[model samples]
Target: MDQDGRDQNFSAASQVNGDHVEVVVTGEVDMSTADALFRAATPDGVHCATLDLSAVTFFDSAAIHAVIRLADRYPGALEVRPSPQVLRVLEISGLAGQPWLKPPS
Candidate 1:
């Protein structure tokens, strides 16, 4: 865990698997919390970054921007599995259609 991971308001954990990394996120993600998501989404030399937002309970536009920033930073290496709440926001923000954002199965 990095310093950013220590944020008590938000919790993010990352696991590296070969060329890919999976980041699990929970709690609210807003302007104040998006930085943690951004830090968690960092590729850190991995070819792929997957954001597991299955536990996210709340999010805002900043959360959407955090995902977009990850996409811009990593190009086609970003994948997102958003929770129901996060999914609604992503859909409203139109980020759900991005090629980098994998649709929930």
Candidate 2:
């Protein structure tokens, strides 16, 4: 828990496994909440970060940018599990084929 809960529209829960960290993200992810997600993922010290966006109901470009920036900030260290809707956004934004995004398995 950080500051005012209502101010941050997204929430994250993290679990570490070996050299990876699974970060489950819930709620909307937009300009207003992207920073929170960034802060949450930046601290785990795990080389690999998996963002479970299955629970995410909404995602904006800012959110996508946040993910991309984090991936760029730590190349080969970020992965995203975006739902079909979110994936569509990423694809439309020309970021779908990036190696940081793991194919659903």
Candidate 3:
């Protein structure tokens, strides 16, 4: 929590599956917390990765930039599954249609 009494909950955890890695992210994501997101999104020696933002409640452009950086690290191997909140932002930013995003089922 910050001085504003808002729930500043933020967390990112990674799981390794063979050469692939899956990063699950949750909570509010803003500029102040984007760096940590980038760090958690990048796992060494993992060519393929999945960023599951389906639990995120809030996010901003900083999160978009973080995803971009992660794309740089993993290239074509990064997949992002965005929550409704995140999906709205990504759609607004024109990133929702990017190849890094997991196609809707």
Measured by TM-score, the strongest candidate is 3
- TM-score winner between candidates 2 and 3: 3
Residues 5-104, candidate 2: write the lDDT tens digits: 4545468887888777788998888887888788777765567788888778788988987897789767878889987777878888998899887656
Model 1 Cα displacement at 4 (Å)?
13
**Local error of candidate 1 at residue 18 (angstroms):** 3.0
Tens-digit lDDT string for candidate 3 (26-85)? 998888778878877666777788988889898998888898888888888888998888
Each candidate's number of clashing pairs is 0, 0, 0
**Models ranked on TM-score:** 3, 1, 2
Query: What is the C-alpha lDDT profile of model 1 across 23-88, one tens digit per residue?
Result: 999988887788877887674678789899989898898888888888888788888888888888
For model 1, the run of ten residues with the poorest summed lDDT = 1-10
How much does each candidate deviate from the true structure in C-alpha RMSD? 3.6, 3.0, 2.6
